[model samples]
Target: MMSYQQLLDQRAQLEADIAAARAAERRAAIAQIRRLMSEHHIASHEILPRRAARRARLLEGEVLYQDPVSGATWAGRGRPPRWLAGRERELYRVNLESQDSREGR
Candidate 1:
């Protein structure tokens, strides 16, 4: 029969061995994944698609109209806002030249 101290020491050793084994396995798995990715010519973006790319495309157009009261902007892609309702949309059309100059274009 092992003493209490001896059993505790054995448990500690077993835990250390388990941790080492886990680390080795993780390293091997990472290496295997890198090798497979290289062989298949897989890009990181292909695996993890960018939501930012889609959002950027959606917001590609410049601001076409703005509300003078609230300073709200719209790209004129979707339905007109309430501020522009029953109003001439051309009245709120953004001046491209002034906008470009403000942006240091």
Candidate 2:
């Protein structure tokens, strides 16, 4: 029974009412959250969880083992080199001379 313009106006008014209601709801929620935070003595930082970042790979430190003949080096980290599998670890121990040379000695 309403005119087209009246129907359009009603729809616009309804949309505005919905928007206002949503705004009020959001305000209420924020007020409730603030109250809860104050009641529990919760800080903003405490509300959010701390992120644990992956540790970065460090610089390779001093070498622990080496092959004198081939000059291959290992820092004694991770898996041992294939050539060192059956050999005595002391036999492949990195000498002070090699370390010093690497350090510009």
Candidate 3:
């Protein structure tokens, strides 16, 4: 039996209460996370692994092409290097057979 205006006011107050509760809970969570990080001596990098580190690990010793003249290597990812530009990429491909033989494969 509440009036329309009374119900609208109640709704507004409920929304404000919800927002305040969310803010309080977020602050508490952040505080707990900080405490745990401090106690464990955890660095931010350890928690959030770097994409560059993973990329380097994956590309390690994985040269797909080589510039015979300069001996520069590429893993055939991203943009082609200056020496490899405007040329057939297959010409610069590393000799996989030679490489496999050298590795005793």
Residues 1-105, model 2: lDDT tens digits: 999999999999999999999999999999999999999999986865444211111133567788888888887778999889988999889786766787884
Q: Using lDDT, give the best candidate's number.
A: 3
Would you list the C-alpha lDDT of every candidate in the order shown?
Answer: 0.87, 0.80, 0.88
lDDT string, candidate 1, 43-103, tens digits: 7778656786656644876788999999998888889888898999899999988977887
lDDT computed for candidate 3: 0.88
lDDT for 24 in candidate 2 is 100
Q: What is the C-alpha RMSD of each candidate to the true structure, in Å?
A: 10.2, 15.3, 12.8
* Cα shift from native, residue 29, model 1 (Å): 0.2
TM-score of each: 0.46, 0.45, 0.48
Model 1 scores a C-alpha lDDT of 0.87
Between candidates 1 and 2, name the one with more favorable TM-score.
1
Clashing pairs in 3: none
List the pairs of residues colliding in candidate 1: none
Better of 2 and 3 by lDDT: 3
Best candidate, TM-score-wise?
A: 3
- Any runs in candidate 2 off by more than 4 Å, and if so which? 52-105
